[model samples]
Target: MADKDPASVQTDESTGQPEKSAQELVLVSEVLPDRIPVMPVYPRPVFPHFMLPLTFSGEKFLEIIREAIEKHNGLLGLVMISELNEQNYLASGLHTVGTVARIYRCSQVSEESVQIVVQGLQRFERVRVAVREEPVQLWEVRYHYDDRAVSVEELKPHILAIMASVKELLSVNPLLQEQLKALLQQVSYERPHMLVDLVSSVLTAEPAKLQDLLETFDMRKRCEKLLLLLKQEIEVFQMQDKIHKQIGEKVGRQQKEYFLREQLKAIKKELGLEKDDKTQEIEKFEERLKNLDVPRDVLDVIREEIDKLKMIDTHSPEYHVSRNYLNELTLLPWGVYSKDNININRARKILNSDHYGLDDVKERILEFISTIIKKGSVSGSIICLQGPAGRGQNLGRPLNCQCPRT
Candidate 1:
């Protein structure tokens, strides 16, 4: 496998100097170690012609990796962890199909940690576990080649279909378009297998699904899988874009309504319409308060409510509720007092005239009127004339008797 200059550079942590660039070519004819130290990577599978950055901790693990870098020319096997448990990695428990990675750059992160950038060289399958213990986890791996028996002519249609899907993806997914365009410029249709590997690495898919594509050696089958993934990605992007546009339109309409309402308010103020209405309403409330002699505490509350109403938006429901409360408050008879004008004989005569054969009810009302006259007020007292419906209750006879309005 060969590639141009890598897209990223890793700097040494201690020395603060850039590492050597991985611009050299690696041919298939070059010697590769059959047994190599294997490291477990997680979440994503590495594809050939792709670079993955990995972090390692523990002094023993770092030392083992350092020995592999020194003795094996930085060549190692990286396999994805089937389970996410970190303990599984220490036991050399990983998927069999993995990539043969070459260390492109290494950096000392700290005393117990190291970071390395590796470029996948080829697809490899673990033949056997050579060593599985602390500080040493080696695997005997065999490299596999992409099916080359099929000529380029046989893959032209597949290649075209993938490119078309990529184009569709480019139109919907602008965030990844730059990287996709860069990859497109680097890849050629002649190397359909390489294109499939490199392109599939960047596209979004499940790790297991990507691993399945990575293990697929047949060029035609890999192309088919890659095309399907690209189409699915396009669909996801399209759906996401549709949801975003709907949210944007709804927000835009609300903003437009708010803006128009504000503009209308400004126009009305300019024409002396809105300000005059608000001022007139406030003046009417104040006038009512003056006529009724509202209590000082209640006056303060009503004034505060009016102030709040002024600050609130006229189109808001709170404004109307506040205004109605203030109107009711100002209209109440806050300081109005009732006079003790009751006469027991006059009430008895009025009740006797209003109804017949209700002597007991008339007697009770006369006694209540006498109590009011004695107390000088009807405070802490209620006079309820109870009787059956349609009976001569004579609720209006008290008015004729000149009962004080309590």
Candidate 2:
């Protein structure tokens, strides 16, 4: 085709389908070649009529771009790279179908890399890759077009379906509205394939799906496929919007609880509490219990109740009940005590001043103290002062001259 005369271009003016310009016809001949340099990249396959820039920092890729532009008038094919490591992908991940992009502009970004704006001009299928020991390779490709055609009248239904789906998608996802509007302008009323490329350019699916769209040659089927994809996107966007709204509603309902919790936490923190009042209270209890002279069995009971207090929410009604239990526990004489030594003579004088009768009781109390002094260790015993209320009832006051108990 390169040696032959340019193919005659034809179109109808009424449908606004202009004939291919002489410049475009010449570009077409370049793609018919049996061998072309293929740029294997990780980007989504570029559809025809869409333009994007490629940045190449590697000297090899930059040289390839320069050779394609300077030596062959920017004739190159871009295949999608499917592997994570671009080194291996350059050799094995090359997809057979790719776009022929023309580098219309190139800029020297730095000594290491260059940036080039390449517009996808056509879709081509790789017939074979020219295997060589060199890092970069060329491909023998043929220009392929889906010859299966559908009339404009037949494509109207699918196009309308796509329009409705886009509108629905925009309702839930208005962020892309302006971009969609700009892309929609690319839709050609006469050519369904133009609409396919225009819509598919902005609609993001996986790179594989977009690649599938670019490789498709059946113009009408492409539009149908896009419509289905757009509808699926709409459903997904709607569901996401619904879940977001539901979560918002849940947060709204819990606003009071959240506010209360934060306020409580802030107040407790100001008072040197780390979590909540109950938690701080429990921590204080634990710290005190450590230095406290509590019996082992009683300490275990106190710790178990403290754990229960921790499990109870600060907002619960039973929190006070547990708090009351802790208060009762603190009421016990934790470390208080009395000395065993007592002055028998001072006790006899206090008995004479505080009491009138019960001379036998006074004599017996003196005798008991003398006995306790001689014994040196107290044996548990109950001492009762008899007679009237004022006689010797207060005599038990001095009995606590021993260890205090809860």
Candidate 3:
């Protein structure tokens, strides 16, 4: 698609008119306002209730904005450039139908660009365009907006269908979960035409389709078309999600197979059944062993076990046990020691703070700790910790988690 002209930007400059959604439509009476400034939107149709923010450039549009704000107090016209004939933009390039919108804000975004916040006031058809030698265009339009009266009962089924489809779509998409939930709630009490228009804002489709929806003046038909669009969107999203999941699973399976094949290759090389450099495995083992800080006796024992492991056939059951033993040996803290910070005063304070009437236990713990300090070693293998049933009876079992059999 071709880029839209720089003159085609929506602008707004009013505040505190009414609390409404950018998607909520405002009712318009038959009273016709006179000539207003025209803004041609080549991009998308600004449906009723659309509070659209846009960026625009070009000096002609700026002049229109100036006249609209300074003279007319933020009142303007917007006609979408869709399937129209050879009508000149500077002369006549719009339909008899257009919108009367307000400028909520107009800010100079850059030297070449300006941002404008616009809200569609109401539909106005039977417009007469006024061209000028100057870079501005104006429109004299009459407001045209009316919808057939719709009973809530007649709209209930279609509304329920749309809600169900939206819910289903939202279920699969977690990112939209909270935001869509609020939007769905807001759609509940709106009129049928307003409800469909609000939903069109949420579910983006082709601009042409949106133009069709904006042209629909019947409330019942609008709801029906909106429900169909929602169902179609839901089906498309589901199919796309299924395809994505299938592709992901296929990729994962292929990756797993690749990893397994690489492992098998290495294993075959290690068993001297392949042509690859088989010594890399033993080199890796040697490098790992040299980095350890084991006692001399333990180190010698591990080296002898490694040699035995190299000579033995790995298919035997004894191979797994030998491997597990080596793994356990590597994990052991060979020369590590626990340095407990012990002070008699701090210990007394801790004991008193932790428990009342445990003076005897505290004294015994202090005496044992002193003996261990004097010896410069942990002298006992098992020290009984007496406490309430849940406090100490089986607390030390957690220490068993330090190593596992495999």
Candidate 4:
């Protein structure tokens, strides 16, 4: 997939020469409002999509908006607030990197409210927050520049790889696959900014992760982060597919058993030797049960039930009940208790040795033991929990159960 040259950079085909002058690095801080009230777009914290329209309703914010409109180039640092609540907006944890957005349109909705639409241009990092008495906040920002320039040829392979991975991930959903294919085709190579925007739209990442990318001034790092995110998405799809297949097999087995029962009934009616077939099937099931290596107690009960079933008719109630019991017994976990040894001396030594600064834990254990002695006899079992295991054992009879006098 080749990217078309941006309109700004493209030259006349007839001239066969470079068309426009080299684009200048536009510094966005010059036009930005010095002390503008920042209103965070709550739902979309990271600005991956188009410019968002924000309302400035407070007295301080209204004045800031009016000043921005009057200047014809009021730029405000569009920052994301860390926490939003009724009391106050917590902007302390706000990312130092933010876009210096220029106000494009402004309209007065009401006496106190003003609606403003701003277009984000370039990224900036907040350097310092100046102390001020003005209603709005003021911060000194520096232009965070990305000097690395990637040529059109370099980006082609990367863009192609990204498109291929996306297609594979969305193959299960027809609608998403088509939409993603069209999106990849429409990306303009001439405008690297447009390509950046498109990649952001297609990938779904957490806000914190995206913020980390936005803070990065390096384009190479940004592309690497996007690739890593797409790879993670592919892994998620594979895990989901495995889970679906496992569930399907369980359902298939149940259906197979039901179908076999229906076939057996028809076979009995068609054949004249119905009694002989029934006797043979019962004998086969009994042999299989006896061969199974199960505990003697459970095996004895199963043998008795099978003997009773053989005496009853093939279509009798006893025969069906015995079949269900055998199936349940075969599925049970027999003689499978995990062996774990409880060493009281080792446990006590481990608890006291591992932690050097845990005086409270040691004190609590001593207090518990004191209570046990005062009671003459412990009422219930004592559980000594070590890590994941909870070991319980009864204390043997003692000559002196009462607590000793201090």
The TM-score values for the models, in the order shown, are 0.68, 0.59, 0.54, 0.45
lDDT for model 3, on a 0 to 1 scale?
Answer: 0.66
Please give, for residues 158-182, the per-residue lDDT of candidate 3 as tens digits.
8777777778868766666776676
Alpha-carbon lDDT of model 4? 0.59
Over 4 Å off, model 2 = 2-34, 83-87, 131-133, 146-149, 260-335, 338-406
Colliding pairs, model 2: none
After superposition on all CA atoms, what RMSD does each candidate show versus the true structure? 11.0, 15.1, 24.8, 18.3
Worst window of 10 by summed lDDT in candidate 2: 1-10
Which pairs of residues collide in candidate 4? 6-190, 32-75, 33-75
Cα lDDT tens digits for candidate 4, 1-406: 1122254455569998657655533344443333343434443343433365788676767765664556435666667655555465433346666666777788889988888887665566676875444545556666553333666667766766666667677874344677566766766655555566556644556766767767766666666777787787677767777787888898898889889977786688578445465566666666666556678888888777767766778778877877677656654545443332233344446556654655776555545555655665446845354543221121211211222111
In candidate 4, stretches whose alpha carbon ends up further than 4 angstroms from where it belongs are: 1-38, 41-49, 52-67, 71-74, 83-86, 90-92, 103-118, 131-135, 145-148, 169-186, 237-406
Cα lDDT for residue 356, candidate 3: 81
The candidate 4 region of ten consecutive residues with least summed lDDT is 391-400
Question: For residues 229-295, what per-residue lDDT tens digits would candidate 2 score against the true structure?
Answer: 8887888888989999999999987997899988887988888766756766877777776666888
For model 4 the TM-score comes to 0.45
Better candidate number, 1 or 4, judged by lDDT: 1
Question: lDDT per prediction?
Answer: 0.78, 0.73, 0.66, 0.59
The C-alpha stretches of model 1 lying farther than 4 A from their native spots are: 1-29, 57-64, 86-93, 110-112, 275-288, 295-332, 339-406
Give a tens-digit lDDT track for model 1, residues 1-406: 2222233345788999766545323455455778888877778888988877889988776977887788778987878878776564565447889988889898999988999999888888888988776767888877775655687899999999998988898899888889878877887998887788878988888888898988887788889989888988999999999999999999999999999998998899899777645666788888887777777888889989888877887778987898888877876677775543476666667767777876787777778778877877767977664576533334545644323232
